[model samples]
Target: MARPRRIVLLRHGESVGNVDDTVYEREPDHALALTAKGRSQAEDAGRALRAVFDGERISAYVSPYRRTHQTFQSLGLDPAKVRVREEPRLREQDWGNWQDRDDVRRQKAYRDAYGHFFYRFAQGESGADVYDRVGAFLESLWRSFEDPHHPPNVLIVTHGLTMRLFCMRWFHWTVAEFESLSNPDNAEWRTLLLGPDGRYSLDRPFDRWCEPESYGVTG
Candidate 1:
């Protein structure tokens, strides 16, 4: 085995912070929990997964954020069948001190004006930083694929931006291509299947479409 036969990237369902962006102003990002509807969405996602997997064992790598863990729990996958691991590298981008600031709108505007991929927030990580970590994770994934004991199916539960960056890194998409991708909806998922060439290919187009914007920034 040189590549996982199947890979599923899932975004966590709506969290308290998603319902009220201002919650991050007071609560730590990692502490944000899921909403009631988010739980339902997670269960729905689990049912969809069960339909696809059909009793096949899966290895899951979940972000350390509370909401992601809660989403995984809500998926209702059998603990005896699915192997779960907490992956810090899959955690949400570190907003650092920016989380407590009230200027998120302005910061987002600045990022949009400049470049989301390279703009580093004040004392925070950039999209490129996240890409680097995800690249490392991909390398580890390839190694896992070569292991005899590795599971055939893999699941990764992570944040929206992280999921986008993971695809960019995995597929070697250009910055323009990366920027043109919108975040997947809460609890949404995408699949990749290993091809005959021993490489993974997207099973389908993203659920959402994004248009390319001219952000007056080069490289």
Candidate 2:
């Protein structure tokens, strides 16, 4: 039987990492709060989403990170209407042992070895690592949808790597193809529609400016 429809996805308005890029970050990493620009970006994202969904019920979930929580706060979603649940599985890739490294030589060497995030750092997890975790998360989410009362519209806030990996599976993109997707900007969300037939489709990312008139959805 076709399952009930649902929407699950990442949050908007958080930077790639802590500004001190030289640091070798560890799991439960350092703070990477959204900039002022990021907050504005998130607001716009919220506006766009509200326009699309209108009065549809939304079940919202967020990673246990300050940036993600703050992003939603900026959106001004009512706490009563949108219950925020935190999940560690939704957290960023734990970049262990790669924190606080001021050594340009080592950093450059590591970057070269990994080829732009292909390598698992000394104490860090790999993209594949995150993919595994998120995969399980998705599986559990689907199980809940099996319930007749599950909400039709859902939202999730997560990091770039996680989003990339999850979307890769949905779109049937290879590693290279997934890597080719634009790195989502802070406060830019990607929306997906999951059909009862178990098919996933991309809606739009938060960073992209979307006009209601453009989509012809009149409020």
Candidate 3:
């Protein structure tokens, strides 16, 4: 096969940040840990992933963020059969330093007014910036495909936004297409299965989200 037999992108389990915006006021986003339920979610997700792998070895690229690292550990995959690497490119979209909740909310409104792809977060990155790094990460991934020792299955444990950008880069989706897609649920994963033709197809395409304010409907 020209590429791995499968490429699975797994969003990290729910973190403290998911339930409490105040966590960002105290802890760095990169350092947040998963919630108790999130640990359970990762365990279930791991079982589901094993079913998908069906005895094949796993080659995993995990984001360096604490939550993702914890998620990867919780998966319970055989450490002996899985090769793991910490990939910073797989980290969450940075909102920058300790967050002020109200300010973050205001920025999101501005982001909505602009476009998802182009809206640069203050002291952080625009989606385009993330896209560039994800693209670079893909180049390295392709290079890894050339090695005979590369495992047959690949898993990426990362953030939801990073996962979407990954599919955008790999599938060559347009900005509109990207914008229309919703993120995978926390601890949920989307798979890319390799067919006989050496191409990849999503096990299920991402769900679509409506732009409620679009189409100029006046209230």
> What are the lDDT scores of the predictions, listed in order?
0.86, 0.65, 0.90
Compared with the true structure, what per-residue lDDT tens digits does model 1 show for residues 30-135? 9999999999999999999988877878999999999999999999888888989999999998877427556776777888877889888776788999999999
Q: Which structure among the candidates has the greatest TM-score?
A: 3
TM-score of 1: 0.92
Encode model 2's per-residue lDDT on 1-219: one tens digit a residue.
234355756555844454546433443353567768778877888877777656566677787877887777787665556656777887887756446555534754775556434656566676777777887887877776776766557788877767777776556555555444555756656778765566867876423232222233221
Cα error of candidate 1 at position 109, Å: 1.1
Better of 1 and 3 by TM-score: 3
Residue 179 displacement in candidate 1 (angstroms): 0.3
Top candidate when judged by lDDT against the true structure: 3
Error of 2 at 135 (Å): 0.5
Q: Which segments of candidate 3 are over 4 A away from where they belong? A: 211-219
| Reference-based TM-score of each model | 0.92, 0.76, 0.94
RMSD of each: 2.8, 8.1, 4.0
Please give me the total number of clashing residue pairs in predicted model 1: 0
Q: In model 2, what is the error at residue 44, expressed in angstroms?
A: 1.9
Tens-digit per-residue lDDT, 1-219, candidate 3: 247889999999999999999889999999999999999999999998888888788889999999999999999998888999999988889898989999999998999889888999899999999999999999999999988878999999999889889998888877777788888899999988999988898989888986433443332
